[model samples]
Target: MAIPRQQLLVVSEELDEAELAALKFLSLEHIPMRKLETVREAVDFFHVLQEKGMIEAENLSFLKELLYRICRIDLLEAQLGSSREEMESELQLPGRAKVSAYRYLLFQLSEDITEDKLKSFKVFLGKELPKCKLNSKTTMLDVFIEMEKKGILGEDNLSVLKNLCREINVSLLRRIEEYELNLSGREEVLIPEEQKGSTGGPKAQARGQALSVASDSPGHWDESSWLEVYKMTSQPRGVCVILNNHSFAKARAAVPKPKDLKDRPGTHVDAVALRRVFQKLHFTVAEHRDLMADEIRKIVDIYRCKDHKARDCFVCCILSHGKKGIVYGVDGEEVPIQELTTAFTEQNCPSLAGKPKVFFVQACQGNACHKGVTVETDSGQQDSSIETDTRLQLDYIPAEADFLLGMATLQDFISYRSPRRGTWYIQALCQHLEYSCPRGEDILTILTAVNQEVSRKSCNKVEKQMPEPGFTLTKKLIFPVS
Candidate 1:
């Protein structure tokens, strides 16, 4: 049965901006980002949910959960004919809730984060998201939406959230840890019992014999073997393409005065660090410098077209100026980040399908500067100065899996650089890779370390930066150093 329009209208009329935003955030997994962005009112959002088959007259469970999640108990009781206690009991059943525990946890965290920490959180994620998404009026719910769009924050992928919470408030990390533990416990409890074959049949006896023979064989798989990880053991582990755009002479002439990009003097430091690290990890590093937008695409196409059947993975690093959703070419043209990533999809680059395609972008996502929080410590402070790659700029993985995108900073924020030492993000990334990869750590763990390390550092003792990593990998990706 279809839900009556009048009832939806009545409930929609009761929703304010805060409640509406909460509903949208909770519905992110159900509705597409583009469609959700166009929804101007609660009624419109409900319509979209209905269109997606998420809400109906008979299936009002999702709506009830949404109202419950937002703590609109009055609406739940009056409109949905459900109460908070009923929802609590219903949600306790296995797989009963529509909104994931992870999503609910984020919403709860958003509600709990203080205004000052919220400001700090926005600054930390400034470069990984779009400028419009992180304005002065942006809320924690808004930040989580952008993070989901970037594929950084999700039910399964919570490293970025965990890192952010650890930096902002160590206490919050406990919540995530508990959630993970609970998930593990549930998985263990949900394991199915093996089905028995017919008691006195020849087929059943044959099946038992076959099972006995298979178990006796040396090749027989164990329970531990079920936990599969990606194979990163290929020699010269695929191609590592580094598009290092250091000079921007053509950009200065092509772009207007205010948007004129400066030459990245210390980019070579990053290039050298990346080359050394990847070389140590036994990768064939192909470095290109000062490429235009078209040229950048062509270079990626060249790698994408390569027959990478012999390779275990692919890596591409872009170092340049950018704004939200785009990176600037040396000649002042724009390259949509999505274009480069989608080019290597299973349909586009068949040879690299099923293999991890890692992209580490070292560019500004926007022009916002991250303000650092003052820490009270007994140690005396030393004077220091830092330069920022503050030019405003702009996830390629969509249906296709096995991709990781590590951004220098959150969207709309500036990432710092040193004329001599190299950019904070790239340098920290290389350092962590060098240390962690050799110790058998996976790529996600290494990126988390990078996030922690970069978030702790401040330029001029007032400005800070945080790196954001997003991935759709199906298995653990550990680089073999030897």
Candidate 2:
């Protein structure tokens, strides 16, 4: 019943004047424009795009980025219906001053950016520019063009990106809601049909039994047990805690107030998608909304106090506002990362013992804003961290387990947020979890997907935050793809 197609080719040459103008706003140095061969296919693909939740526009630049961005208009539409006046007021407000303010604050924190170096940064912020398109075959440029065609660069209209970041950052207080969700219950992983054969069933049962015994055994075993027994099935336990923190009561003063931060429908759309995906994979997700650090310490303390009975693996998702190694409490206080995870340390909570402890922090790490990256012929040439202080202090701590740390951005840097939607890191994390978790994708595989999605879907200086994962697992995990 499905049409069979092969050697699918898509070329983007029918770019009209406006599209062409949009292209000039782009950095096309690395795009492989000459290799494309199917302009017709690309045009046709753009035609029915709206049916798949695409936004119908006389212009097709937006959808050139991701299938997900199309759903954003539905977000816009819902906002229109809820409060037209508020939406109009925001849209009409002057964003230049606010943008300048954010830029100033960021500049004060780090000298990695400047006005003279903001051309590429402006491109990421979605500023309008002349007509242009790719003129080469560089990988970075190629990826950027691909995203531009998908319209994933998003609307920089009225400085929406800054507003979005402010709005989403406020939702970090919702971490409490995540904790409640985790306390309520967790989804169970289902057995696959193919593995239902008699031999397979017994084999799986035996393996499960063996895993249980090994997981329950005490540490400090002889070298043989470490290699033969523990190494056979030892793994870091996975914990998912979704916390909601702070309130919009003290919202950012950015003009064009973010739609999602105002409780828009698309708020946390990406994060919810990921939670559901991970839930289906039997991840113990603690979905809390609006929790404070004192509360965070208390909850982690409870887990630490009961480490003997605590889960061997750990995954903590802190969805809150942050600066550098510190996240904001609902009271506007700073809570250091060391303070939060100290509960999991051997000195505090020894239950986790020698397992994997993973923390996925989805908040701005600092006030440092996105600066234009120097595009080089090799994409790998870009420095991973703009500042020497980018890596978290946890990197230096002698963690008991193979602790893995995942943060939204580098040091002294603010992660990108979607005014009414979720933070970029959270959204990407959730999407990858949904797409790959249920399929039994390994932790690394899912993280890879998250990295690719964020890198591909976003650009510009301020919005170009990526999720960085540091791990120390004894063995590789493949999430058991079914």
Candidate 3:
């Protein structure tokens, strides 16, 4: 039997350059370095695997494993006819994995290495690798390949890589150390299996005892259990600070003719919704109305100075007029969104480190209105007219980990509002939280639902609004409903 060439071609077309490089990197152990170097496209790499007998119609386990390892679950299911659950179960059997754990570790390191770190790595290895391979466009994956060719990095060798990571970023060294520990544990588990039925020495008996304990515990070897989740079980989960700027009278008075900042009338509805939902979720809600830009900074600093060691998370909702990278205060002053978010960084607020800090901003990112595309709807009814918050700007979230900034709309687009009803983004967000939190849905999943609901809505049959959620969360954040 032969695998369908058309299916491979279609899947190949879906892969971008980075994904192609990832697939090739994962295949280094199975295919020769020379063949992989010549394989530039995904289809060509698949052909090399097919020729090497690693993938065929009857045997596609290796190909499926490659796709699964690269986190391409979509392609694994749609094209390869294999699900993640099936792959997980199959890989549980020892020696079924074609990709070594060491290889996967290196690939993950490459993925996480920043561009600046990559340049540093190239400079450090300048004397070791060929000068031609260390160009400006060289990625971490390419650097890893060069190191492997130099015989410094391999399945059993990671000293050079560890030293490089230690110099570049101390935090990254933890990954390599964890990989080494897990690799050692796997070796201990395999000793008993390989030397079964022998009168093993004292060391062998101890290994057997360790294996017995591991076998008894179902989650002992479960890799997914290694992932740490944000602890959200505190009595009062955290504080929910709502900065509602409904009266912008001072802004209107200070700004000149064309740039008049109007009062936000319907924002109270959003504030009420947020307060109710977060309070129901057991957060201590603090609602501040009509604040100046300086006042906003002071309030955030007050919260930042608070002892949040017992808290599991923090939440802030800013409802005001905003421009690119800033929100306007009631007094017509600009407050940088980055400044507000960075106030809670680990350095400034050590008590809140490793906890999720969520910010939801309901304001126009810019003056430009988003035009809607025609879509078939089941409802025959239509809204004749709708209102909008005329304020405008873009958004900003800090680069640090464990922060999430949910914007009302994309940059340069005006978000919708109603004189009676709240904003399209905030209302939808509250609705999703109210519905999904009790069901144990994570924050990102809830935000995606908000995005879908808000994008479907249109004002005056032409203007549409799409919410955006940017995050650097390192774990699944599920709000406690009780």
Candidate 4:
């Protein structure tokens, strides 16, 4: 009746002191399931049993009892903080922050599904299914297959499940089985008193059978769980192209200059800041300082080829004086926004097909800026992308996913810039990112702050304009992980 020395040693070595005491308490005196230390430890203990092939029916029952005990521990923890330590002084497990942290870690660990796969799963859940019900004892595979037939699960569903399994730790999949068994309660049957010892082996075998379930389980999720969703940080790797067509074919051409122009076209802050920020971000930025629309499209096409396999994300920032829907190329040719964005449709760029493709435009969409009401309306901030008359034209493929276009101003407006400094939008954007991007804040949040600061500081400048930010992020993005 003595436990094996190796098993005892393994258990002792693997578990912390509290877990060891809990195990001893369980084995020696049938301690309450709630008396253990951490549910994570309990999970680990169950895993050890599984590895030892000791997952008996009674053990599974023990697991269920333990989980409920832990659930109560969680409830208690939710109600109180370190008070669990006081509970532990009386020999009960504390479940508050401990459980919260575990759940959050679990969700982050489980985020292996692609954004599209997530979308598909949501659609399947929302749609009615006459065939499959949660109450049925159908396998998860069966439910998935049925959904696949009903056009619910796309071709990528298998990959999603595989990735999810990998991310959540395949061991947890087995743990999930034990959790299911824990829900079933004790399984009592007719047995002779003398044969009771024989039951342990069968109980272990039964527990092993309970691992794979068909549907989602509604477990308690706390704020930690919410935080877990932010763990995923995969960003698209699209090419960023900046084309400034405002310059002459020759940098020093004697063209019709704006009335107060001092610096020539090539030395604009828009070009300099664009290059500096993109290079810092480690993007393979391509710049065509004065290319026509065709040349720009040609460069884009080179990167768009899937066979060549360029990158996953795409960005294009155009800097020039422009008419509505058209950015001025070097030769003053009009490059329509639709023409620029069209090169990145799903058909042309399959690698970025469902990935985030961001476009930043700095051009006059129209010509409606009148003389200012007051010459000194400036609040001492730099000028912004000018607001103009013509609206920007955005043509996107109906089904293409994850595209974001950040325009300097609203549609049909000129973006402003100073010859000495950079464009208002670029300067503010860089300033905000340099200062506020390190706090694990979302890109949108930082941009909003940037917009407010820019608006407040520059509303009274001569070319008075406000920087605008627009995005189509499929999910949240936090930059500079370090």
lDDT of each: 0.71, 0.41, 0.72, 0.43
lDDT of 2 at 247: 56
| Candidate 4 residue runs with Cα over 4 Å from true position | 1-238, 249-267, 306-312, 372-399, 459-463
Error of 1 at 15 (Å): 79
Window of ten residues with lowest summed lDDT in model 4: 190-199
Write model 2 residue lDDT over 1-482, tens digit each, in one string.
22112111222333343333222222122123432322234444433333333324333223322211112233234322223333445434554111222222222212332333333333443322222432222222233344445433332211122222223332321332232233222321111101111111111010110101112222212432333111212222355666656353332332454211222122355457547655654566667665555776777676667644434466676766655567655444457876776667766666666655667776654333222321111001112332335333345224555566776665544455544445556666655554344444356655655554454333231134455666655544444323
Which residue runs of candidate 1 sit more than 4 Å off their true CA positions?
1-226, 255-259, 370-395
Ranking by TM-score: 1, 3, 2, 4
RMSD of each candidate relative to the true structure: 24.4, 21.8, 25.1, 24.4
Task: Return whichever of 3 and 4 wins on lDDT.
Answer: 3
Clashes of each: 18, 69, 5, 24
Question: Candidate 4's residue-wise lDDT over 1-482, tens digit each?
Answer: 43334443443354464333333233312332343323345445555554544445333323323323333345234322223454445333432212222222223323333445444443444333453342234333333434445533332122223223433446644443343233222221110000111111111000111111111221212322343212223332335677765544432242563221112232256676667666555566778766755776676677666432444456677765554456554554456766667677778766666556667766544333333221111011122333332323343222455666655554433344544444556656655554444434555655564454344333222233444454445555445534
Q: What is the per-residue lDDT of model 3 for residues 227-319, given as tens digits with 9 covering 90 to 100?
A: 567889998999999998877677656745323566776778889889988998999999999999899999999999999999999999998
Any runs in candidate 3 off by more than 4 Å, and if so which? Answer: 1-227, 255-259, 369-395
**What lDDT is obtained when candidate 3 is compared to the true structure?**
0.72
Count clashing pairs, candidate 4: 24
Scored against the true structure, residue 44 in model 1 reaches a CA lDDT of 91
Which one is best on TM-score? Answer: 1
Q: How accurate is candidate 4 locally (lDDT)?
A: 0.43
Task: Provide the clash count, candidate 3.
Answer: 5
Residue 354 in model 3: shift from native, Å?
Answer: 0.7
